[model samples]
Target: MQSSISLPRPIPRTALAQAVLLLLYGASAHAQTPPTAETMLTPVTIRSGAEQENAITPVTGFVAKRALSATKTDTPLLETPQAISVVTRDQMEAQGVQTLRQATAYTAGAVSNYFDSRVDSFSARGGTVTQYQDGLLRIYGTYNTSRPDPYTLERVEFLRGPTSVLYGQGSVGGVLNLTSKRPQADTLREVQVQVGNNARKQIAADLTGALDQEGQWLYRLVAVGRDSGSQLDHVDDDRLVLMPSLTWKPNAATSLTLQALHQKDKSGSLIGFFPWQGTQLPSQYGQIPRNTFISEPGWDAYDTTNNSWGYLFSHQFNSDWTVRQNLRRTVSEVDYRTIYTSFTANAATGRPARPVFNSDNRTVYRDASWQINGGRMLLVDTQIEGKLHTSSGTEHTVLAGLDVQRNQTSQSSWRSVTAAFDVYNPVYGNFRPPTASQLMRQPNVEQRQWGLYAQDQIKWERWTATLGLRHDSAQTDTEGRPAAAIDDKAWSKRAGVTYQMDGGWAPYVGYSESFQPLGGVDVYGTPYKPQRGQQWEAGVKWQPPGQGISAYAALYQLREKNRKTTDPSNPLNSLQLGEVKVNGFEAEMQASLASRWDMTLAYALTDAKISRSNAGDQGQSVASVPKHTASAWLSHRFASEGRGGWVVGAGLRYTGSQWSGTSAISTPSATLADAMAAYDAGDWRVAFNVINLTDKVHITQCLARGDCFYGQARTYTLTSTYRF
Candidate 1:
């Protein structure tokens, strides 16, 4: 089933440049028309010190005062009445993080189950999280999307719990928003080179400043090139990224930022799906080496290319009202191929047993798969914000918005059983290629969704209240498969209240809802109802006045219904009669003490269970969710009369034992260590970092289905950066 609709082509550079010029010209013309009577009557307030902190701006230290993710407004974290975590660029640089998962390692309620280079797979509050860039959703389809490079982002934010009131149809866990680096008025130029273990080499540059004397136009360019090898043999990690942005501020009241991205990745899968016998449990042949390569060296590959163009526009009619519009289009393609171990029938029971290991415990059966996937997505959002005062002296901030999204995807795949290979002694080019008959053509899928939402924040005295509601309608069509088409409509709501107390303490409570549409029909020919989620959370935030510290502790309970489960009446079919519940507690604190020391502490406790299900597995623990996780990081800088200084840091991470979704198997807990040392001079800095300093051999997780994933090994890197 080939797709009849062709993919959209990239916009020409000349056309794009012309369009930008026209927009700037029009904006300038409008600015010259001068201020209206209404604008002249409105008062403008200047922000200084901490009041200048906003969602997209650079932070001075580890603690952030304001974030825009919770309410899509520049609201103080203490007043948002929700749990949010902000990972700043300073924090990422200090920790030497290279991936999204690594950047959030210290955040409460965040978890990563395995190590994979192909994608950044992580979860929060025991459920998968949706990814967003600059307030717009990043629609992904069947391994066709490219991973974001951390170097190109200003900050990463994690919002805990359901957020459907703002973002349409999404996971109940939360939303991970990546803020891109935008043009700035202040000039900045920097270049960095890095070398690390596993034959890694990299270079990166960031340049941003004003483009004209009037400071009306600003531009920024960021690029990275890297080549590295993984802990696994014969697998490489390579990437190229280029991001450029331009901002036009014809006047103080209106601004527009144009951004474009091009990224390409060449990497292979790191997971081998090794049997539990040799990796987790003891075997006659002893433990298998962690670097053993299971897939064919030359045939195994995961390559991707991504391109996107977007703009963020905002205008203020007056001090009391403002409007904003954001739009983006993204196209991605992926070529994936791999070989993994396959289970064989048990000799006596005739049931599928664990991956068949030879008597020597060195050979295993395998299967191969190849796929080509393409995806295109377009997103647009428009919103109006207003501030009003009631007759009773109460203040109100209201917001109303409409957002629409379109996604199209195509895939063709083939799979077949392949020859077995010995793990101890490798042999390649012996397996047969997949035949034409083994090819499978998947239906082209197209989905369109639109949402309308409104929110209000009322404030009187020392109390604040928040109320929100949203309605969403979605349609999904499968090419040549009308029977599978789906039409879904849903309503989401959110409400919260907070009371500001003396000494910088705010205790709040909030309730939020979410929904995700399901596509296929059940065995009875009835369409499955969309999965629904709701959460109740209460927390207290403390950020003492004039203190460079922020802290919060929260408790939440979330429930999700309509999950798919095996039908007891018909084993071959499935039913939507499953439910899950997670009760969790989280606490975190970040501080920059007296400009000499920086530290962060985090702890999380998650209790997740299958509350209801048609299958016999009711009451079972959820897979890949740990019961306890904690981390702490501390760094100190030694000042040397402003000429140069030395900094040193160390951190520890602990993951408690987790259930493998089965009563008979459980993954063990492990704790790892990380350390960094750096020296800063007038215009240059050098740093050395070591992750997993002890090189502990541990299993991240294992499945009852018969495989285990290995944790990352020790890694070392040296980086030198120069600023001009």
Candidate 2:
């Protein structure tokens, strides 16, 4: 489906002038300073003293004590006010995470819905979570954006609550940030081979080292290629990814890094569904097999390609001041096609009747349909950061920058009817092929946006405070009969305070707001106002001495307004009076116990409702959002001191019942299990991991009336890695 609303043209002249002036101000402060004796003796790079410390932080275990995504600074996780979860590379590997969703499945306040396999779908606090990489937005061409392999990432971080103060526009639920592998001064090389059920075969490699003596130049290269089969019969998924980066430091206080990525994916059709009678509820027909293939073999196809490059640069003018800048550009394209059954015919004299399968696993269908679509997208981002210390007894870290983005996407689709297949016992090669003449071009949307933001962090004595503000302007343009156009602007802000005490404890409170431009107009032809979100949060964090545990808990309430909903006067159009409220509590504990045991435990309880709406959905629980979720993971390793190196791990996850699409219908609760074992010797390691160990079959979610999806079935994988 194409977006009905479009972004307008370039921002007003005033906005453009402001961006130029900001850039000039940053450049004017770059006066050259006399070379000191220490600077003359050795070349200093950007990651000098403080930067080098962060770069070398060990990432060998599940516990991530420090993160930069929360405050864009080297702040410890325990000091951040809002609820935050970090999944380190070690944690992902131990859990046998193959996809991005799997990496966050055990974190508090996070729910991963992977029934479709076509897109990365997840919800936090009753709203969809936005995607980010290294503090920058990761643009998606459509609902089905490609997911990066877990092996290519260093860690994944989740920041819960409204964050528009730092990021211009986003979801009220929060943001998920993936940190990529970057060049390092240390020499490291590793390779791994993996194989599992479903014909899964893959190889990955990581190499990083200093390009020259004195560690002035560093480089890193990562690559992965995989060929795997899906639980769906006759369906296959394959991908290839390549990433390379280079870092150069000319002096102790100056450094610059350049990085690039190229990825491609080929997969089978994503539209596979059975009617309500046979799938969601027991029909007289036999239960549909989890691996049933609903689409014709000849018509199923999906392919996408992406390319991106960017740079990170920073310089420390003196002990009290520093400046940093970042920029990136990306382009992506996709092509998808599929042919599947639409309606079913009854087992008795099936012809001409909306086909319904019978108890004997035999049925006939009235007909089928073919759908074809393709599109392209482009994205860009650039920003600058600065830090300063005042003459008074206070410290200041500030950021001022501008970002501009343009997205142009177009889709051409064709649909036609053909002969159908048996529901229980399927047959292929029956549907007729669709033709180009039947294809129709959808409305192409071109959206452009520009935002200017500034933030400051102030610290004095044992007290810390932060304040930020941002301004955004956007224009959406659509190409169709009338060539519709709309322009919008918004302002966002955030404030927070924290107090630190001696026993490794910190208590904080924060307030933030978010906004997102909506795409459609009301029945009266008036553009709908952008959706707005407001949140109030309070939390406490603790890190006990010598216990290796970091824990936190938070309570929050969020409300959103100006949402678009069905118009009562004209059922054909939309209204902007929709409102929603969500209240929740989240708690988490992660530790490396006694240097031999690692454990992580989390729990979340949420209550979400449609507070107001033009339609008749008020007072109902949000669809697909469970009220309670909990998880626990534990692992133990035996050292070589008394026995051969070995490790054992296990985990459990539980999700409570939730409204599927209406207050009257709901999906049942479920529990899942996972286990892993590994052995290490002589710089080599072997491991076996199992997901859904109990082989339980349950629906992750279902749509009203007839469409439902099953969660991942029991699966196992074995991997071997060697380091040199």
Candidate 3:
């Protein structure tokens, strides 16, 4: 255990020109425009079942399954057992995603790096991706933009390992749920349009109708716009999104749903830097000329603004009874500004423009939630159940529940900027943006969380069980007193056993636990204790109604309790010492066998470690996370029921090369290949996408003076949709 190798705190050009003049007021004074070929459609997925988040569901992560045609329903990452990856809405429109870090990029271990804007905030498996949409749990200062553009999604669940039980200050590296898009009862129309390359363009529209005509009430509206230009050099990307939703039913067990959203992102320079030691001076050394303008020529920048409102209610008073209620509220405001150049040890290569690190940031957020699911008791089915004895005949069924949440993220910033060369400045590129002094800052942060939960489900015989308990109280008010707070008590457990294998194959096994409450702190002063993740699972859940096709495989282990650092001779203090491990194995497959050849193949192999970092850097690994990951998808359809349907799809992604710091000094692995082609005629549709299909070239080393930073290259798109 030897520790020596750290660097990443060199962003100062007078503090990036007073953080770009404090975010340039309200931007768009006109000037600084470029990015748009076409964009309109707006779809962003986040909740689905009936198998299609890459198929293979047999209970492995946090339980949420129901299939009959959500493509087919395999969503049983097992009610929080651990390990989850689901991103479907026909695969985010056959791949054209523009955020949430590109819609979970092929999910596997779900590693994300959201191109700047402060890494667009994402970290999973090894932790730190604290974001929630429908159920609202927020954190992301200046929050950087709402980023809604997967066409208004309805699926995006990647719960692959560790969730503090309904969320309690999380991220042992896992949790992402975007699910938004509701109002369906009939009348639907989907439209699309796209053009590719760095000059890509897009347009999309979604319409789900029912207002009169005796259809109670149902409506859905989505809108989006985008413009792009990338390959670096001043960078570029522009966006706008708006979403509206409504759902209501008065019979068959009351129901109600309402949602609203609005987002805008006009960007450029979310930290764009090159020269991993100047790749000897070629990867475009210190480049930034595409018309030289890091924050002036309209100032290469980024902006974000968000607004949200929500509600979901359901009731089934009879027929064994049923009750559920949900509510939500989200508000966001981010006026982010940036001016590249995070130091490149001087510089020289394809260059001619420099300013360096600046920000006029602002982030504000509020989230609310309330949940309740009542109980019921029913019987009669094969007859033979009990609570201590049953053999001659019997039957039983029972269920119970309760839940609550109130989340928030309040941020305040009074930023400033100034820079004139600081990569060890020796004459660095043309540099000039604020030849003065103004190193100012106003890094303010606030967080508040509240959680209370209770649940139980028990069914006799063929055995099905569930038991959960959560009690968390969180409070944080830095910048105004009360630095940190958390009083958490969590326990989530589930046991499953299903057997009816008579050729259609059916097998199952399960158990689970996960919890979180640590927001980075170990420089002593103590504030890092509240990460209890535990897991042990077994698998097999095939065709119960898995009908048309189904499959599953599982084996897992994730344990925790042992952490301590920041005693470097007493800068503060920390100690927990003893225990941390991750073991894994997973497999999958989803129906349509001899019916159309639709498919989803899966694979996962992990062995993260720190067995005992007590020795400190002892065996590192598990930051940014990746031991082994995999995903595969194959699609096919050529129906002739009406002579108008043809589609083809392909996918692959593999990541295995961790270490971004901690003395290991960066190593951002890569393995990407994607393809999509479609042509359907009900109204009209077309597609063609080939991201990173072979333009691979990645690097993310960070040692500062020594340098290292390169990523983003390879893109293509072409689309069209019409439904009138």
Best candidate, TM-score-wise? Answer: 1
TM-score of every model versus the real structure: 0.94, 0.89, 0.29
Predictions in order: lDDT? 0.84, 0.73, 0.50
Task: Report the C-alpha displacement of residue 483, candidate 2, in angstroms.
Answer: 5.7
Tens digits of per-residue lDDT for model 1, 73-181: 8788888878998998888888888888888988888888778877787787878888899999875676897788889999999999899999988878899888999
lDDT of 2 by residue, 428-470 (tens): 7766767767777787677777787887877887777878898
What TM-score number comes out for model 2? 0.89
Over 4 Å off, model 1? 1-31, 35-48, 343-356, 432-440, 640-644
In candidate 3, which residue ranges exceed 4 Å CA deviation? 1-83, 86-95, 98-157, 160-235, 238-266, 269-297, 300-437, 440-500, 503-509, 515-528, 531-540, 543-636, 639-645, 648-677, 680-724
Worst 10 residues of 1 by lDDT: 3-12
Cα error, candidate 2, residue 301 (Å)? 1.6
Per-residue lDDT over 461-483 for candidate 3, one digit per residue giving the tens place of the 0 to 100 score: 44434444555555444444344
Candidate 1 all-Cα RMSD: 4.0
